[model samples]
Every structure is written in structure tokens, then in C-alpha cells.
Target: MTVSFTETEAFKTFFYAGEIRLLYFLMILMAIDIFTGLAKALKNNKLWSRKSLFGYARKLLIFCIIVLANIIDQILGTHGGILFVTIFFYIANEGLSIIENCAEMGVLVPQEIADKLAVIKNEKGTSVTTEIKEEFTSSHSRDLEGDTAEVKIKIEKD
Candidate 1:
């Protein structure tokens, strides 16, 4: 029998939250962030094994969070509402970190992206990734104390 649709495939249902494309995007962002972060650390001559492991662990934690969100969706039958929310938040968080990393590495990140990242970073309050990045690359980090507009990104990684 010819297969009609794989939307309900067990593999996709178990591994993905809602849409496979969204998970793909999230995975791409995670990979980009990881590589850029490693590059930034290498350029700064400050690659620590512990921090690197923690970074990888944190990435693993993303999957754990997704699983929890997926379970919640299954229980509540919310149709991936929780999962989508969780994934979208992570995307923004990772995107902001990536932009910051690229800019700090002197990659000439456009002002529009820099400005937008600042907005998102402000929203993604007290990110561990941001803290670690700042810890290693404070020399090039910009001051955010003067921004008037406020955006609060609620990431519960602590």
C-alpha cells in the first residue's frame, strides 16, 4: 500500500514537538550557537573543559525540556501549544546568543541585527550562555545599561 501521509509517524511524534520544520529550525539554531560559541572561545584563547561540557549539557537539557513540554501537551491535549512555546523561546534565546557571539568575534554583524539582538537579549534575562560569553569576552562586550526599552525573555534555565 502506498503511504499517504506521515504526519502521524511514530518517529516524528516522539522526537518532534509539533511541526518537524520547527524542530529542524531549533536544531539548526542550536548547532550554529554551539559552533559560534566554540569559535568565539577559541579566538579569545579561553576554552575551558568544564564550561564546554556544561554547554553541551545545557544543549542536552533543551531536549529534556522539550520532552517535558511534549508530555504536558500529551496530557492536556493542547496540540503542541506548550511544545511550540518552549521551542520558540529557545530559538530566540539561541539566536540572541549567536548574534552576540558573531559580533564580539568582529564578524561585522549588521547594526539592525545587533540592535534586534539587544532587544531580544534584554528579553532573555540573565541567560547562562550570556553570562558565560560575557565572562570570557567582556573586553568586547557592549554596555546595555543605557537602553530605554525593555523586553523580558522568560527562560527558566536556572
Candidate 2:
């Protein structure tokens, strides 16, 4: 099915454009969350069916909510804001759950990544500045305030 984009001024600005679709933004956000979770899982060597299923379900729910929001907008007018709010809520929830899942699997999910995720959740659709990106990448191996966890990977001998 084909859908057409309409220009509507809401919140003092145009909400939708001809090129940028809401679905596209949602997909990118969901993909980032899923990949981040998967990376943490792999780092801990605990990637399994359960975690993958959870991530998939979470992504599906986010997309479903977006569709629901569009339906609501059609039914009751002025519901785009509600869609943004729902997206933000799920984003934060899924982000936190990913961290928790990593912790369960013995992955530290470093405070640095957690902090970066928090900032992203708070900003909600804003780009991360260059300095922030550098700090995030550099935070991986450096000790923060000299507090670091020693991750011990065990190899079972055959």
C-alpha cells in the first residue's frame, strides 16, 4: 500500500516532510537499540535465543505503537504529540531493559554507555555532538574515576 505525506503545521512547525517519514525514524531508533543490546550480549558471550526474542518483541511493539498513534491522530486529531510521548517512553524502557539484560549476562554495560543512552533518551531524536561521540568511544577501555570492573572470561577446557 502507498501512503502520501501531508504538510501540517503543529507545535509551531511542520511535523512531517515529503522525504522524512516517521516510520524511517522509528526504524533507525529501534535498530540502534537492538544492535547495542546485541553488542553487549556478544561481549559477555551470552547471546541466546531469549535475549534475541525479547529484542525482537520490543521492536515490534514500538512499531505497533507508532501505527496506533497514527490511527489515533486520524480518529481524534492532535495526537502526534502523544505518539512522540509513547515513543520516548518505550525507548527509555527498552534501553533500561537492555542494560539490565546485559547485567544479567555478566556484561558490565559500562556506566559510560548507560550515561550516553540516558542522554539520547532524554534528547529524544537529536544528534549526538562530536565531542560526545569521541567520549563514548574512548570510554570503552578507560577507567572512570579509577573505578573499573575486571571482566573475567572463563574458558572451559575440553
Query: After superposition on all CA atoms, what RMSD does each candidate show versus the true structure?
Result: 10.6, 17.5
lDDT (Cα) of model 2: 0.57
lDDT of 1 by residue, 1-158 (tens): 57534355664456564877787898999999989999999999989887788788889999888878887787788988889999999998888878888887899988888676566455556445566756654353445545589789998986
Model 2, 1-158: lDDT tens digits are: 65434434341133332123444655666676677767866887878775478558756766666667655654566646666666667656655655654554566678887666557543444224323433544355374667868899999999
Which residue pairs in candidate 2 collide? Answer: none
Prediction 1 global C-alpha lDDT: 0.78
Measured against the true structure, the TM-scores of the candidates, in listed sequence, are: 0.67, 0.45
Off by over 4 Å in 2: 1-22, 91-158
For candidate 1, list the clashing residue pairs, or say none. Answer: 123-151, 123-153
TM-score of 1: 0.67
